[model samples]
Target: MVKKLISVGSILIPTVLTILIVNFLFDIVPLNIQGLPLVLPFVICPIGAVLGLIGYKMNRDNLARAGMIFNIVLFLFPIAFNIIGTLSGGV
Candidate 1:
């Protein structure tokens, strides 16, 4: 149960950080001096991915898979958003 909780946390934290980073990047959210959101996802998502992979190897399949998916989406979203914005003249 504890491992499952960690897996869920691994998913949620990075996902939320991704949203915050994107919002900050696009100026949708006001910036503060503490810019952890700017740098945290790069650290957190990779760590989460590693943890998820370890969990998968240990057979905690569902939660681990969810974590991996969330980590992947967190990494990809900003790049995809930027590309779409550029193409659509929204950037």
Candidate 2:
């Protein structure tokens, strides 16, 4: 059970923390980022993509594949967030 917990955490914990950190950084950073401020919110996908690619190269196993796939999904999370927000009456 401990191993399972640790294994699950190895991937999820970093992803969640990285997401929070990225969001905080984005919010505080200036909006004058040469127009990137409009698109930088989509940065999460590349972040997860890179993590997945790294995991694929280093781990070389099912877990690595899982990481890669989840990274892509993670990348989409921002878009999903936007959609959900709009649906829920958020701006």
Candidate 3:
């Protein structure tokens, strides 16, 4: 039960954060402080991925696997976004 909850949270938290990050990056949501939005994802995504890993180890569930995969993608998202932005001359 507890493991499942953690697994769900690992999925939810990063998904929400990823949405916010994408919004911020694309200027859909205006944020006054430039660096503020980025800091959380770098810290949180890894934590979420780790939590998912731990949950998967404990319960052998699909939710944990999904969570981990999402977090990994989330972790790479910024780098990819930046690369694309650079190649395109500021996205």
Q: TM-score of every model?
A: 0.66, 0.46, 0.82
lDDT, candidate 2, 1-91, per-residue tens:
4433333443674476445646554665444334342244366446545655665565465664665566566556556766986999867
Using lDDT as the measure, name the better of candidate 2 and candidate 3: 3
TM-score, candidate number 3: 0.82
The lDDT for every candidate, in the order shown, is 0.75, 0.54, 0.84
Worst 10 residues of 1 by lDDT: 33-42
Using TM-score as the measure, which candidate wins? 3
Q: Once model 2 is optimally superposed onto the true structure by TM-score, how far is the C-alpha of residue 4 displaced, in angstroms?
A: 18
Please write out the lDDT profile of model 3 over residues 5-77, one tens digit for every residue. 9999889979888777777768886877676556677788999999899999999899999999999988887
Residue range 1-91, candidate 1, lDDT tens digits: 7677667776777778867877677878677835666556667788888878777777767988888888877867656766888999965
Sliding window of 10 residues with minimal summed lDDT for model 3: 33-42
What's the candidate order when arranged by decreasing lDDT?
3, 1, 2
